[model samples]
Target chain A: MIWDWAFAFEILPVLARAAIVSIEATLIGFALAASLGLVLAVVRIAVPWTGWTISVLVELIRSTPLLIQIFFLYFVFPKFGVVLDAFTAGVLAIGIHYAAYCSEVYRAGFDNIHRGQWEASIALNLSSWTTFRDIIIPQAIPPIVPALGNYLVALFKETPLLSAIAVMELMQTAKIIGSDTFRYTEPMTLVGLFFLAMSLVSAVLIRSLERLLNRRTMR
Target chain B: MGIRTLVTLLIVALGVIAALATQEAYSLFLPGLLQGAVLTIEIAILGSLLAIVMGVLAALARMYGPAPLRWLATVYVEIFRGTSALVQLFWLFFVLPQFGVTLNAFLVAVLALGLNVGAYGSEVVRGAIQSVARGQWEACTALNMSRPQMLRRIILPQAFVAMIPPWGNLFIELLKSTALVSLITLSDLAFKAQQMNQNTFKTIPIFTLVLLMYLAMSLVVTIGMRLLERRASLGLARGKAA
Candidate 1:
């Protein structure tokens, strides 16, 4: 009752295939969030007029569950003449939900850029674009990378929720296997271990990246 | 129109559209949604209470206990934090019976959510406790205080201040996570909304209503937490000044 070695071995390969979908969803979703979040952060700053609306939108997204957002996009959007497959809907919901978090991280980085840098840019008669590209962005981005990396790991953990919309992600596949064979322990435990391995490896990778970014900036 | 006015207009238009879309749904399924909302709240409140307890105990063990206890705490934290709460719930619900540890659905939901959230909360607690000034620890020790007295009288109060904001954030996260319980057949808010979707096939209105309901509850939780934080910080300030 405590352990089953052969069954665990049996499920490992099955879980691995499903893990690929989980990884893809995480990567694509994170890519969407990272780029969209940067755009959102810059837009809010550059267009103060849109700040309130954007803030409201971000807050609304952050406050609600990703599950509801997925449900809304999957089911409701079609009624309004937009259609998305399960994978796309899951990716979009997760990506958008995390964009709200990423935006705050970007905003923090942007805010941390000191007033002196802006004055220096103005003194040199550097165009705003040149100033941002040359000075502000380079300084703003390094500290933000670590935070962004954390969201990547979080997005990976959240990939399981895609199972709800029938995405056949790692967790869903494991659930299916469990139901079919009535051997729940092995597959479920393997999924947890699967997540555990990825999470630890990501954490280590992010730490090293953070260290690298700090060193590069120091030079 | 000004931006505020425009934003207001947009929101009003959305409300009008929702009202129009959900005319029949409002009458028919409102109670079901409300019942679901109540269950969601119950699960969230109880789960969070258990999480805080687990977090504090784990933090305490990690910080002050000997080698094996610390290792146990660390392993618990990492495993729970690393995994998905949804997967954790499924494992508890589906897998436990195989091992002859069959609990009911509600208890499983609470345990899974509590353990998942408690892991993260333990880190928060540990970080806050460590961030308390070294001088405070030395001062208490120099006064010949025992470990328990030192922690209770000196360390915990200050550390508690730093822990509140993060705890508030975790609370909202927990609230949003309650939506996942519906997948485990918990009859929560999300489950009822799914039932509505199946029955009416009106995904638009039902899901939109559920979304708004979640938003409303989240707002309540956030505002309530802010008030709690303010009250707690005021007490902290008084303690420091005294």
Candidate 2:
């Protein structure tokens, strides 16, 4: 039979457990990307001395494939006495790679703020920290929430790359099922459906978030 | 001199020194890696052409075709866009044979990547086409031109300009994704790197070279797209002046 429903049902529990790993990786990686990206963006802007170096680093990361980055971290780092487990390497690689992208989104968000807003904060004799925290971040964040959400979804899709490092993510688990039973059709199809469902759910959530933020900003 | 210039020069010098120090390693790895890179470029170019064709067709179908075509196009775009490229590649590579359809690994790579990127490209195409002014459509209608005539002559030229930059981005994306083909057992660039790494256990130099090669290709794509954008906008401006 091309597809065995009974076999698919049998593998559901294992695949479900693996799916949790994938989800965990996505969330942790995104958190790292988000916070680290904001710092990278802020440093590039606030500390003029570091701007060029950060820009070059971000550009290099952005242009390369994430798989190679994972490989570099997983394989090469061990030689320099900085070994990482597969899951850690995968998460860090994805987090750092997407951080480059997320930083750009943040930079764009900051750039869109009006000059008057900054000048007003200065005229009020606000401290830099207070101005940034009170004036800049709240305004900068809302508009970029949708962009960051897109990266979240993108990062989720990237979780399968973790499988390449043998992290036993959903794709790797499915591949193991296929190899063990030689019945790939069911496992592959199931994995694909899982991804489709998760991504669609995330897309709907992001749209509503955008609407909710918009309604709040309207007031 | 500014610190930035000194830093930039220092990086360039380091890169040169690294290359000089690694000459023996380069000769050992370059032939296999270059052959893999050629295949990588081949897949990227062919996949890009397929993606452009699929993207245009799907976008037009969704926008202006009959109900069934629109429905089919929507399904195509959503399903392809929703899943990971690696899953798509594996499904095509490993599962299709169960249904009595066995494709070559190379063909499967191109098809999967093309369809996946084409899904994203469809949205870009749709947006660019929509950005063409409503008044232009009215103007075409008033002139008694057919739908295809209006789209071909008036709408597409303007839309094409906007599409180039995004299309360039998608093309680079397609190039990066070609790395996944390695997992499907095609000896693409990433596969060669991994294969070489396993043979010699020289992780640093192998991966470094591979990363630099990918970075160089992506830079070329960026510069090429920028040039296309410039030439396109110039033509439009000149046409307006005339």
lDDT of 2 at B210: 85
In the range B135-209, model 2's lDDT, one tens digit per residue, is 999999999999999999999999999999899889988999999999999999999999999999999878878
- All models, DockQ values? 0.83, 0.88
Candidate 1 local accuracy as lDDT? 0.87
- Give the DockQ of candidate 1: 0.83
* Residue B233, model 1: Cα distance from true site in angstroms: 2.0
> Which pairs clash in model 1?
none
Lowest lDDT sum, 10 consecutive residues, model 2 chain A, at A55-64
**Model 1: CA > 4 A from native:** A123-128, B1-25, B239-242
Cα RMSDs, all models: 3.5, 3.0
Native contact fraction, candidates in order:
0.92, 0.86
lDDT digits (tens) for residues A50-99 of candidate 1: 89788878878987899988988888767878888999999999999999
